[model samples]
Target: MNYLKKILVYALPYKRYAILNIIFNILYALFGALSFVVLMPMLNILFGENHDVITEKPVLNGLNNIGGYLKDSLTYSIQTFAENDQLKALTFIIILVIVVFLLKNIFNYMALYFGTFLRNGILKDLRDTLYTKTVNLPISFFSEKRKGDIMSRIASDVNEVQNSFLSVLEIIVREPLSVIFSIAIMLTISVKLTLFVFVFIPTAGYIISVIAKRLRQQSADVQKEQGIFLSILEETLNGLKIIKGFNAQSLFNSKFTDSTKRFFNFSNKMMNRQNIATPLSEFLGIVTIAFLLWFGGRMVLIDKSLLASSFIAFMGLAYNILTPIKALSKANNNVKRGNAAAERVLEIIETTNPLEDIPNAISKTNFKTSIDINSISFKYEDDLVLKNFSLKVLKGKSVALVGQSGSGKSTIANLVTRFYDVNDGSITLDGDNIKSLTKHSLRNLMGLVTQDSILFNDSIKNNILLGKENATDKEIIDALKIANAWEFVKDLPREIETNIGDSGNKLSGGQKQRLSIARAVLKNPPIMILDEATSALDTESERLVQEALENMMKNRTSIIIAHRLSTIQNADLIVVMQKGEIAEQGTHAELILKNGVYKKLVDMQSFE
Candidate 1:
């Protein structure tokens, strides 16, 4: 319930709907109880216990007397009927019971009808907020988490909260009120009997509550375990190639099975506990009803304080309380289960985004002189990847980073584009600290071409349009031509409209890389960062793509991370890195003359 209270902000928008539902529910409760009460007078007349009044005048009190007058007039009419034909009065009582029961159900239906708006309104707003939060959250938040787990939280967990927990609000409010109204009428007829009924309820309630105490925790565990297995499933599908290549299908199979087995065990315990609640509470309610029949029957027959018809009406009221009691007990379990889901969802909504814009951050729309990396140091964990690494790239000059694997070439591109921030020192653009600029504005000045294409399962035109939403067909074709992808795209059945399957799997390795470069080219930013852009291609494809890359680099400040030392020989400046520090720096010819690490690497390749 405390968790529910936290989520109440979502309900504020639909307060009017809630108010209307409550009004109708109150009327439904009142009429539902009154229907049983009306049965008592009808029973009395039929049994000949109370002869109907022959009233000629009525005692009145303002408008309030209207009810008494109607009762008196009905009593006189019944007397007239009984004198003429006794069977007719009996027929009228049965008709009256039927009418009251009809009205009771009518109002109940109306209460539920209005409640639909509030229920669905909460669901729509909650899903919307969850989606919005997912988009605005930082990239780093996803680094340590599984994509499948997040998807499960958004889809299944939210649905559980709605179907199971939110339904309880209606049962808690409307059903309990009906029970209260019924109990009040029962007490009015016989306070002593009602008081006796109360004693049995608390004992039954205590036993049910004790069993339900740990149910919320168990539900939470079950949901979390489900997320674990869902994550494992997602990982297996995404990395199927790696698993098969390494002959590790059995390894992933065992991991997935283990996760599902734990989920199965947890789910079994949660459902078993929930299933027991309904039958156990109902059994206890039946026992209480039996005790009431014995005790109340003795009072009516021997004690002489209770009438036969009134005792019958009281039994109806007692039976009515049992249904609500059982319903509320089941709803209580639902609320607890919902509480578990709500807590998980709320954790996400309440979590603070570590990366946020400064209040006064400026927008950097253009690069003036150069990008400067001043003594920047960073690490993913304890082991540092870059230490006091400094570099400079003047406007329109090409700078290439050439090194062995894990030499922090890609990290430089990441920091310059603000995909990540440096742990120490600063990276600045045109003499202004990159952190001082808005992230959106800082990233807009640069375009990136990674080794992986990162294409979506979308049309070719739509994928290229991602670079610039309002780009024209001509512009897209021009970018494609520059990337050397236009040739294949023009040959496709739908041409630009052709659908690229998941991660562009429908295309060849070279084709996907060309499409990636086309996207960056379409952006046409002032600076470009190519992180081993041609590393994954064959020799023939690399030669063609490298030519396309050179054309795109014209008149732009480019930072290239190169795997082939020969490809960067013509670069204006080549940075040689070894173990997170500068090992050599100069033109490729100068580095080869130095006969250091760069010379050894070049000689190993045996540059002709």
Candidate 2:
């Protein structure tokens, strides 16, 4: 019920639809009972009972005996009509039956019509919140989670929540009202029979409850297995090239099949348990009806207290109770299933982000003097990636960081961008700590070009425009020219309008890197961080990309994490790092003369 309440809170925005649905459902329930109530007069007519004419109109009585008065009034009208024209009386009764049925169906349709808005409105809001939370979460949060599991929570689990949880809103209102109204009519028809019905209902409810004991746990297991298989599918797609390269298709296939097999077993158990409620409730309903027939027949035939027409109407009202009783059982099962899905979705939605901006964080818009990385220490999981490391890049002065793999060169760039905060010490820009500034404002002052050029599967123009949201055509062309991308772009089939495939796969390594540089150039930030931007390119391509980097780095306070020594030779200051500590820092000429780690690194690359 707690899970259900949490899920329903999303429906508050669309409460008008829910209220309308409830209103219509109430009307539907009233008409549903009245539909059965009118059947007594028609049955009395067919059986040739009540042959005496009603000379006077029936009187209006108090609310206590309204049911009895209504019955008498209807009988009087039928009898009065029969005296003048028997065909007309029969026709009137048939039309009344049809009108009652018609009104019942109309209210039912209106209830469903309004319910559509509530169901779909909840679905849309839930998905939108899930997607928004997923995007807003820090990058580190994904490191411990499977992409497939997250995808399942957003897609499959949300659908389950809709079907099992949100879908019950209408039934919860309509079905119960139907049962209540039907029971009320049944009580008026015969109190003794209705009392007998009350005895078996609790017994049936208990039996259904016993059958549903393990449904919630089983449903949770099914949802978990779904996430597992989806994870395997996602991983398979992402690493298909590696799998195919190693001829491991059968391995992934077996793993996926195994997961699906578990899913099948769990799903079967849950569905079988869920499927039992309908037949069980229905079977119980029939038993109660059969018992009522025997007992009611005794009263009408022998006892002579209950009328034949009233007994028949009582049977109809009793039957009406069964539909809703069955529906309530089914709804109970659905709620159990939906609870499991709700837990999974809410887990993601309610996660606490450690890297969220502080309440009073300053929003710094521009860069001024140097960026000082103080005695900073950081770790990802157990191992320390950077320890007591520091560097300073003055305004408009390009600084380069050269190091071996895992030596924390890229960690510096990550820290500067605040993608991850340091465990100890602080990084300041123009004397103010970077953590004190809003992440958006901090990142707004800089542009980054990574080792793998990240471009969306979009047109070249759209891809470049991401750097500056409202950049003009001429600005895009100039940025592309500055990055040396315009040469190849202009020669393409549609030039800048050409569609790049997924992750810009249609373009070569050099072309993609140039486009990335063009995007950064378009932004034209006060500072630029180029992390091995040309490492993946070939000789000629590297030269072209290197030229573009030089153009982008010109007069910008640049932090270059370089693999190729030749590229950073003209840097104002070069810092050489070993492990997590800096081993050397000086100009390229000074570093070469020192004959330390810097000189040795240069010598090794030269030999290669």
Candidate 3:
């Protein structure tokens, strides 16, 4: 219930709709109960059990005897009509039943109509917030979490919460009111029979509760299995090439099949348990009804304390209670199932982001003198990736970092960009601590291009426009031409409007890299961080992409993490790293004269 309450808090904005739904449900319940009550006078008319026709109207006295007075008044009205004409009286009673049922259904529809807004509104808000948080969270957050698990929470789990929790608005308000209204009429009809019903209801509820006891745990297992299988599917899609290349498709297939098998088993058990509620509650209701028939029949036939017409109406009221009771039982199961999903979703919405901007963080608008990394140390988990790392990138100068794999060259780029803050010491942009600046404002001053071309499934122009939301087409074309991408882009089917398939797979590797550079060129930031920007390219593609990077880096304070040392020969300063520490620092010509790490790397690559 606490989980359910947390979900319902989203409904606060739509309180007026909720209130309207409640009002309609109340009307629906009132008319639904009255529909059965109207049947008594008709029964008397049919059985010829009515005693006499009365001309005087019955008067209301006090609240306590209002039921008796209303019954007498209805009988008096029916008797008067019958005296005038029997056909007219029978027609009136039949029309009254139709009108009562018609109003009941109308109110029921109204309740459901209003509830639709509340359910869908909450669903939209939940999904939107999840996406907003997912994008705003630091990149490091994804390193420890599965993408598919997060996707499941946003897509599948939120849907489950909607179906199980939000959809219950109708059942919670309408069904219970129906039961209450129905039971109240039954008590008025006969206290003994109503008491008899009370005895069995709690017993039936206890049995149903026991059946649902393991439902929540099983539901959680089902949701967890769903996430696992989805993760497997996501991994399969991402690594299909590797799977085929290694002929390890069978291994991935078996893993996926095994996960689905568990899901199938858990879902079967959970759904079967949920399915039992409707029938079990219905059967129990019938048993109670069968008992009532015997007991109430004796009161009417033998004891003569109950009227035949009133007894039949009481039986109708008793039967009416069964539907809502069954619904209430189903609703209980739904709440249990929904609570499991709600817990999973709330875990994400409630996660405390460590990288969120601090209060009163200053906004940095431009790069000034230099970026200073002073004795910074950092780690991913417990293993230090960068230790006592120190460097300075003076404004408008290009600095290149060259190192072997796992030597913390890329870690420096990550720290300077604030992707992951240093575990020790500080990185200051100009004279101000980078941590003191808001991330949006801090990132606004820099542009990034990674080894993998991270393009979306969008038009080529739209993809580049992401760097500057309001960039003109002419600006886009100029950026593209500068990155050496305009030649290929102009030849595409739609020119700049051509769709780049997922991750720009439609374009060649060199073309993709050029478009990435174009995006950076469009942003035209003062600081450009190119991390292995041409490492994955062949000779010809590398030549093209290298030219693009050079064009983009002109007059920018550039921090380049290069795998091919040849690409950094023209950099103003070259730093060689080994084992998370700087091994050598100088210009390319000076580093070669030092006969140290930089010269060794250049010689090694030249030999390769």
Candidate 4:
């Protein structure tokens, strides 16, 4: 129930539509009950049952008698208006029923019409909030989550929240009001029969509730299975090539089939439970009606105390309440199902972000002096990845890190970029602890070129413009030239405007890597970090990208993480790392002259 209220808070902005829907639902319920009650006077007239028809409206004494007085008053007015002509009275009664039925349907349509805005508005806002939260969450959060699971929350889970919100709202206001209004009319007809009807209600409610007891758990299982299959689909799409190369199609097929099988079983259980509501309510309804017929028959026929016409109208009113009661039963089941979805949706929205910036954090805008890694130690999980690692880079100089895999070369880049916080010690920018700086301000001063050559499926110019949204054509051209990507780019049909296709697959590996460098150059930040920017290329491509890197690094504070020994031979300082600790630190020639770790690495690369 708390989860239900949490989701409802998103309805604040659209409360106007919500209020309007409620008002219309109220009117609809009133007219829906009145639609049947209006025929009572007509039935009385046709049956010649009104023995004392008055010529004027009767006066109401108080609220308690208002229902009885109104019924009597309507009977008198119809009798007077028709001038005691039976045919004329029947004709007028038929017209009144038609008007009442039409108004009931109109209000029903209006309720749904306004409800559309409230339902869909909540949907749009919830999805927007979820997406913004997902994007702003720290990268570490995604390392533990499946991409498809997040997608399911945004797409499927939110949809369920919207549906549940409206279903509960409709049950809370519309259906219950319908039953209440119809029951009011029944009470006016016969306090005896209405009381008998009330006796069965709680019993019916208890039974329906018992049947729906496990619905929430079952619904959650179904929703979770949906997330699992969606994850499988996403993984299959991303690793299709690997699956095909490894001949593991049967493995994925079995996995998908198994997930779907669970989804199938869970769905069957939930739906089979929900399906019991209608018939069960109807059976309960008929049982209550049977009691009414037996009891009321004593008054109408055997005892001759109640009018036959009024008893018939009372029976119709009793049946009217059944529709809403049955509908309420079904809606209750849906809300229980939706409860599971709401819980899943709110779980993500309510999650605590571990990387939130500190209060009064400095928004430093420029790079000055040096970045001092003061004995920083960090870990991704249990074991440490960086152990008391300390290094310094002066402004306008390039320092390259060379190491084998798992040697913490990339961890340095990640820490400096503020992608993860250090578990111990501190990294300070210009002598102020980086934790004091806002992450946005910290990242703004550095441009990163990663090994993957990340590119979007968009125009070359648009992809470069991501570095600086307001950059001009000349600035972009200059950046491209600096990164050595302009020559090949200028030959394309659309040149800078040419679409790169997915991950720039239309271009060669060298071309993609150069575009990544061009994007960084266009940003033109004071610091540049290149993580193996040339390791994945052929010698020709490596030479071209290495030259581009030199141009981009000439006037910036640069930290280069590389595997290819030749790429860092000219770095101002070379730090060779081994197993989370720096094994050597000096210029390339200096390390070689020492005839140690750097010397062996260079020897190995030379042999290869």
Order of candidates by lDDT, top first?
Answer: 4, 2, 3, 1
Clash total of candidate 4: 0
On residues 1-608, what C-alpha lDDT tens digit does candidate 1 reach at each position? 88877877887898887777888888888888878777876787767766545646455567535544545665666666666455777787778779888888887777777777777787788888888888777767788778877777788778777765345665767778988998877766788899999999889888888888889999998889888888988888889899999999999889989988888888888888888888998889889989998999999888988888888988888888887777777788888888888888887888787556778999888888999999999987789999999999999999999889999998898889887778999988988999889988988999999988799999999999988999999999999999999999999999999998988999998899898889989999999999999889998888878988988999999999998876787888999998788888999889888989889888887876
User: For candidate 3, lDDT tens digit of each residue in 421-496?
Assistant: 8899999998899899998998899999999999999999999998999999999999999999999999999999
Cα displacement (angstroms), candidate 2, residue 270, comes to: 1.5
Model 2, residue 122: distance off in Å is: 1.4
Give the least accurate 10-residue stretch of model 2, judged by summed lDDT.
163-172
In model 2, the runs with Cα more than 4 Å from the true position are: 52-64, 77-84
Q: Tell me the tens digit of each residue's lDDT in model 4 across 1-608.
A: 56878888899999999999999999999998898788887778777886775867789999788777978888777878888787888898899999999999999999898889998999999999999899878889989887888888889888987888768877989998988998888877778778988898889889988998999999989989888899999999878889999999999999999999999999999999999878888999999889889999998999887788888888888888878888888877878877888899888898888777899999999988999998989999999999999999999888999889999999999999988899999999999898899988898899999999999999999999989999999999999999999999999999999998988989999999999999999999999999999989999999999999999998899999999988887889999999889999999879989999989988989833
**Alpha-carbon lDDT, every model:** 0.84, 0.89, 0.88, 0.89
Considering only N, C-alpha and C atoms within 3 Å, which residue pairs clash in candidate 1?
A: none
On the 0 to 100 scale, the lDDT of residue 551 in model 1 is 83
* Highest TM-score scorer: 3
Clashing pairs in 3: none
Give RMSD (Å) of candidate 1 vs. truth. 3.2
